[model samples]
Target: MKKYFLKLYQYNAWSNKRVLGTLQRQNVNDPKILSLMGHVVAAQFLWLHRIKGLPPPDVKLWGEYSLDQLLKLSEKAGKEWLEFVESNDNFDRQLTYTNYVGEPYTNNVEMIMVHLVNHSSYHRAQVAMLLRQKGFEPINTDFITYDRVITGQLKE
Candidate 1:
């Protein structure tokens, strides 16, 4: 489970950098795209904080951040997730946390991790489409595409 989480986190970082690079090529003027990207990192931090029994950071869901700022935030989240995955042993460990609407829920580690990655992916797709609508071609951030680049023969 740890190895699986590590792989997912690694892939998440790789995909994030690709998307950030594409967004960086633009002038960082699109508020919609910026909010989506910012929310990715903000939600990651919020979840980590919740899992660690800490208060959420002063980041809003739709916060505006420049691409460079988001790049730094993305790197921070990746490093934190990698460390957490390596340190934790029980994937089924349960955690209780409150959502933005003050609704509380308990979830196992595996589910939380899956939700984190899937949430980012959902927003990344939105970012890609937003770029497309603006006459720009977004890079392919698909898991299989990343896998092909990292493992030419599918060694994993």
Candidate 2:
């Protein structure tokens, strides 16, 4: 499970960098793309903090980070996730954390990790749509495509 999640995180990080880079080169100031990108990184930060049992009220779910800062924040979140995924001791552990609205919940680590990936994919699709409408070709972010590249099934 740990190894599987590590791959998923790798995919997540790869896809995010592509999207951020595309946005940076195209329209970094687009409000919708910026909002989506900001939310994606902000949510990741909050979840990582929660998983680490860190203090609440420190991370924001909808933080408005600058376009230039998205990559830095994404890199920081990737490092945090990689450190956790590299340690498999508690992969099946359940975590208890309160949501942004103060609603408490309990979820296993695996479920949380999967949710994080899916959440990012969902928002990425939204950003892709926005990018298309703005006459930009969004990066291909499918998980299987990423897997094929990583597994030597496809050329770079």
Among all windows of 10 consecutive residues in model 1, the one with the lowest summed lDDT is 147-156
What is residue 52's positional error in candidate 2, in angstroms?
0.9
Q: Give the C-alpha lDDT of model 1.
A: 0.87
TM-score versus the correct structure, for each prediction: 0.92, 0.92
**CA lDDT scores, all candidates in order:** 0.87, 0.85
Clashing pairs in 2: none
Write down the lDDT that model 2 would get: 0.85
| Backbone clash count for every predicted candidate, in the order shown | 0, 0
Q: Report the lDDT tens digits of candidate 1 across residue range 64-148.
A: 8877789999899889988988888877889988899999899986898899999999999999999999988788888988788
Residue ranges of candidate 2 with Cα displaced over 4 Å: none
**Candidates' RMSD to native:** 2.4, 1.5
> Could you say which candidate leads in lDDT?
1
